[model samples]
Target chain A: MIFGLVFWLLVIYFVARGFSSRRRRGYRWLQRELPSWEQKNIINAEQGDAILSLYKLKRIEPRRKMDMVKVLTLIGAIFVGVGVIFFVASNWQRIPAPIKTILIMSVTIFTLYMGYLFSYQKEGFVYLGKSLLLLASLFWGGTIALIGQIYNIPTSQNWFIMLLWAFPIVPIAIFFDNAYVHILASALFLIWNFLYTVNNSVANYYYPIIIFLFMLPTARKLLISRRINIIGLLVASLYCCFYKYEWLSLLVSVGLLIYYLIQREEFVYLYASSLSFIFWTITFFTVRKIHPNFYFFIPIEIILYLTYKDKIRENLIMCLVGLLVWLNLSIYSFCLAFGYKFNVINFIVMQSLAGMVIYIIGIISKNREYVFSEIYKVFGYLVTFVCTYLLSFQAMIELRAQVGLNNVYLAVCSFLIGIMALLVTNEARKGYFENKAVRLELFALASALLVNLILLASPSVLTCTLAANAVLVIFAIINIFLGVELKMSSIFTAGTVIFALFIITRYIDVGWKLKEKSLFFIVGGLIISSLGIFLEKQRRKVIERMKQNE
Target chain B: MNKKIIFFFIAVLWVIVVAAMIISKQSILRKGKAVLLETLPVDPRDLLRGDYVILRYKISTLDLDQVKSEKPYYKTGEVIYVRLEPRDKFWEATAVEVKRSADSGIYIRGKVGYCYRKELGVIYGIESYFVPEGEGREIERNIRREKSSVNVEAVVDSKGNALIKKVYIDKNS
Candidate 1:
C-alpha cells in the first residue's frame, strides 16, 4: 500500500510535469526536431504524436549549457543520494573496523573524483558541482538519521544536546542554496525530534520555528514570493499553539501581519491574518473553557472582526465562516463537556445578540452595506436555529414512532437540510449580503445546519459512511460553485480540504478494504483517474482541432 | 590579494582536515595495538561513547584455581594494572601489579573508559580498547545484539609484543 501510494504520487508528479511542459510550448517547439512520421503509423494522429514528439525531444535534446551550475547541481544530488545509501549500508554498529575504513576511504575518494571533475576536466562543471553538493547534503542528512536510529533510546537531554549541534546546519544549507543540504539535514533532525516530542513534556521545541524563520529571508529573495516561508511560519505557529505557546503565537502572527501589510505582500498578508484569526479563535475557546466568567472570547472576536473587516470581502466570506464554524464547534464541544448545557433558545439568542450588535455597529458607522447585510445574516441564523430545532424535534418524535430509521431516510434528511441551507445561503448572498462579514455569518448558519444533519445522520448508518457520502456531495457542490464564481483560492482550498479529508479518513480504511473489494475499488479509482486524464486529452484534442480549422 | 585568496582556501581546507583528525584521533592511534577478543561477546549497549570496545572476560567459561585482586580492596586511591596471559584458550590475569597501598584494587581499561573500583567493589567508568575509524560502526551494531560478537585475536611473541593478527566473531555456542 505504501509503495503503491509512492508510485501514484510519482505518476501524478510526472503527469503534472507533462501538462506544464505542454503549456510552456514544449510540443510546438520540440516536435520539429523529431523525424518525419512513418507511413505505417496512422492516417491522422495529431495530439498523441505531439505528446510523443515532445517526450522524445526532452530525452534527446542536449540542453547545451549543462555548464558549471548544472554540473554542480547534479553532483550535489548524487552526493546526497549516495551518502544516504552508504550510511544505511554501513550500519555503523555491525561493520568491522577494516570494512568501515574501506567504506569511508571509498567515499572520500569519490568525493575527490567529483571535486577534481568540477575543478578541472568536467564539461558541465556546474552540474557536476551541484551533484557533488547534493551528494554531500544527502550524506550529511543521512548521517543524522543514522545517528538518531543508532541511539534510538537516547535520553531527552541527549537528544536536545544533539539538536543544538544539528539544527543549525539546515539554515546554513539555505544560506548557500548551493544544495538542498539544509532541507535534508533539517528533515532528518526533525524526524527524530518529532518522535521524541510526541508524548513528552519538552516545551517549545524551537528547531522547526528557527528553521522556518531562517528560510523566510531567502525564500523572499530567491523564490520571489513569501509563500513557502508563510507556510513554514504557519506550521510553526500551529506547533506553538498546540504545545501551549499561545501568547508567542499571537505575537508572532501579529508581527508577521504588520510586516506583510507594510510590504504589501499578499501571501504574507493572508498567512498572517488567517493565522492570527486561528490563534485568537483557539484563545477564545481555551479561555472560555478555563474561565467561563472572563468573557475574553468576546473581545478576541471583536479584534478578529476589526482586523478582517475590510479584508474579508464577499469572496472570502465562506472561508471566514468556515473558520468561525470550526472555532465555535470546538468551543461548544468543550463547554458542553464541562457541565455547560446549551439549550436551543440560549444558543440562538446569543448568536442573534452577537449578530445584532455587529449590525447596529455597522449602522452607526454608516457602513450601510454592513448594516443591511449583517441584519440579513442575523435573521438567517435565527431562522436556521428555529428550523434545526424543529427538525431535530421531529426526528426525535419520528424515532419514537417508528422505533427505527434506515440509512436511506438519514441520507434523505441530510441531503434535504443541506440543499435548503445552501439555497437560503445563496439567496441571502445576492444583494442583502453586501458585507463579507454578514455573508460569512449566513454561511456559518448553513454550515451549522449541514454539520448537524451530518452528525445526526452518521450514527444511524455505518461510522464513516455518512461522512464520506456527505463530504463528497458537499465537496463536489462547493467545488463547482467556487469554480463558476472564479474564486481561485477558495476552490483550491476546498479541493485541498477534500483531499486531506479523504486521505485522513479513508486512506488506511480504503487500503484495508482494498483487499476485500480489491477489484471493485481499484477499478473504480482507476476509472476516475483515467476519466480525468481523458478529459485533459479531449481538451487538448479540441484545442488542436480548433487551431487546424483556424 | 590573489595569493591571499589561495591562502584562504588552503586555510579552510586545513581547518576541516584538522577538525576531522581531532574527532577521529583516538581510534586511529589505537589501531593494531590490541586484538579484539573473539571468544567473548561484547554487549551492544557499551559501544557508543567513543571507539573503545568493552568486553567482559567471560570468567564463567574458565576453570580457575582462584580469582585475586592485585591491589588493596579497602584503599581510597590506588592505581592497579593486571597482566593477563592465555591459559587454556582464555585470557587470565597472571600477575597483579599494584602501584600503592593507598588506592582501590583491580583497575581495567578495556570497555568503559579507565574504570576504577572503590573499596566497595563497585567499578565505574572504564575507557579501554580502541578500534579504528570505520569499524566503530560495526562494533556499535554488535553491542546492540547478543547473537554474535566481533573479536580481535592478537599474536603475542615471547618478548611480550602484542600485535593484532585477525578479527572474527566468535559465536560458538
Candidate 2:
C-alpha cells in the first residue's frame, strides 16, 4: 500500500513538473524572442499581430476544452470498467450462473450501444464514444472469462475465448476507425494465436497467414495505423522464432520487404522490413546453416543500394550497417568453409580494414548531399578503436608467452591503429562530423587505448580482467555524468545498463551470502542514489548555463 | 451505413459462434453415455484456474502387454481409440485400435503422449476436474487422511470425445 501511494505521488509530481516546465519554457521563449524576431524582419508587423492573435485564440479553443473533457471521460470510463470487472469477479460465486452471464452480456451490449449512439449522434464527444467502445471490447473479454468460470471450463479454452473476443473487436475497430481498438484487437488476436499454439503443441503454420488475411480487409478499409502492421510483423517473427521454420522466416521477410518497397514513403514499413531482414539473416545463419547461400546476400545488398540510391540520403546509414553485419558474417563463414583456423585478431583486422576502405571511399566521393559518407567515417573510427583494443590484448598475451615476432607485429598494428584513430578524432574535431558529441567519444577512445596498453603489460590474466572491469565501471560513471551535462537520454540509458551489468557480474562472481549480499546491496543502493542526486544538481546547473547562453 | 450493417452482422455471427460452443457441449452432456473412471488425486490447486485436482486414471498409462494392434510401432501424437470394459467397480481398457470400429462399445479417444519400453502414456482431455475455490484443499486433505478414492463421472460421445459430468469423492455424489 505504501509503495503504491509513493508510486502515485511520484507520477503526480512528474506530471505537474512536466506541465509547469512546458509553460515556463513557452513563456520564456515568447518574452525573450518575440521582439527580436520582429526587429530582425523574420516577421512583419501584421504577421506578428496575427501570430499573437492566433496564440490567444488557441488558448480558448473549444476543441481543446472538449479534448480535456474527453480525457476525463475516458479515465472515468476505465475506472468504471475496472469496478465492473471487480464487482463481477467478487460476486461471481454468490450470483447464479444464468444471471451472471446475462448481466455481463447486457452490460457489454449496452456499452457498445451507448458508444455507437454517442459517436454517431453527439458532436465533440467522438473520443469519449471511442473510449466507451474500447471499454465495451474490454468488457466483452471479461464476459468471456466470466462465462468460462461459470461453466467451469478448463484453462486450455482461454485461446477460444480470446478468439471470440478479438473477432468482434476487429470489426468494431475497423468500423469506428479507432487506433486503440485496433491495437487491442491485434493484441488479443496475437495472444489467442500464442495460446492456441501452446495448448495444441502444434506449429500452426497457417496461423500467421490467416491473421494477415483477416487484417487485410480491415486495414484496407480503415487505413490502419502502422502500429498494427508492426505488431503483425512481430507476431510473425515470434512464430518463426518458436517454430524454427526457415521458410516462414523467408516468407515474412520477403513479404514485408515487398510491402515496404511498394509503400516506400512510410518509415514504419521500412522499419518492419529492416527488422525482419535482420531476423531472417540470423535465422538463416544459425538455424539453417546454409553457408553457401551467404554469398547471395552480396548481390541482394548491391541491388538494394542501387534501387534505393535516390532515397539513400535518408536511410543509407542503417542499410550500410546491415550490409556490414552481413558481410562480416559471410567472411566468417568463408573462412570456416576453407581450412583457415578461426582467429579473433585476424577477423578484427579484416573488419577494420573494410571499415577504413568504406570511409576512404566516402571521403573521395565527397557526397555532400548525403550524410551516408559521414556515417561511414564515424563507423571507421569506431571500428579502429575496437580493433586496437583487441590488438593490445592479443599483443599482451603474445608478449607474456614469449618475446616473438608475432608479439612485435601485433604491437606495431596496435600502434598504427591508435595513430589512425587519433588522426580520425582530429578530423572529426575539425568539424568533418557535424555532431560535437563525436569529439568527446573520440577522446574517450584515445584514453581507453592508453589505459588498455598499460593494463595489458600487467603480469596476470586476473589483473587484466579486473582492470578492464574497473575501466568499464569508470567509463559508465563518466558516461552518466556526461549524459547529465549534455542531456542525452541514450547515453544515460547506456550508463545505467553498464552499471547494472557490473553489479550483476560482481554478484555472479561472489555468489550469494545472506548478510554480505544484503550489505553489498545497501552500499550499492546508497552509491547510486547519491550519484543520482549529484547528477540532478549538475543537470540543473547545465540547463541554466544553456539557457543563459541562448 | 454499410459499416454499421457489417458490424451488426459480425456481432450476430460472434454470438452465434459462442452460442454454438455452449450448445454443442450441452448436447454432448445430455446425449452421451456416462461412465465412472477411478481417479488418483495429485496436485490440489491450480494457480490461475482456482481450485482443481490433476487426476490420473488407470487408462492414462497403458502397458504394451495389452496391445491388440497389428502395427509394431505407434508414433506420438497419433490418435488411438481404447475400448473399455467394466472391470470391478470401474471401466478398464480391453483393446486398443488405431482406427474406429463399426462395433459400438464404450470407447475413449486419446492422443499418444510417448511410447517408452513397455509403457505408453496417453492424454484423455478430461484430466482435470475443477471444484469451487478452497474446496480442493479440503477434498485433498480428506483423501489423504481416510485413504479415500475419487471417481470422475464422464459422458463420452460416439466420436470418443468425453466431458466430465461430475466428480464423486468416497462414492458421494
Best by DockQ: 2
- lDDT by residue (A381-404, candidate 2, tens digit) is 445434433443434344443431
Give me candidate 1's TM-score against the actual structure.
0.43
DockQ of each: 0.04, 0.30
lDDT tens digits, residue span A1-550, model 1: 1232232234334433443455447544544444334234532356546666444333244346646656556655665666555555345557754454445434643553464356345564645554564464344334333332332212322344345334434433453354344444444455445544442434344543554456444454444224444554455455553555555556556656555555443333544555454554455444444432233344345435644553433213323332433434454554456545433322332332333333333333333443234333323333333333322332333332233333333433444455554544554555545755434434444444454544453444343244334434454345434433443443434444444444433444445456567775776677557655664564455445545655
The true-versus-predicted C-alpha distance at residue A168 of model 1, in Å, is 5.9
lDDT minimum window of 10 residues, candidate 1 chain A: A148-157
The collision pairs in model 2 are none
Error of 2 at A465 (Å): 9.2
Interface RMSD of each: 10.6, 3.4
Docking quality category of candidate 2 according to DockQ thresholds: acceptable
User: What's each prediction's clash count?
Assistant: 55, 0
TM-score of chain A for each candidate?
A: 0.46, 0.58
Off by over 4 Å in 1: A1-76, A92-124, A142-179, A182-196, A222-232, A240-255, A266-269, A276-288, A292-338, A341-550, B1-173
lDDT of 1 by residue, B1-173 (tens): 24234323433443354245334433323442342343333422222223334433342122222444544342322333444545665465543344322333222321111223421221112212334335655665655666456655553322232333445664433
Give the C-alpha miss distance for residue B58 in model 1, angstroms.
20
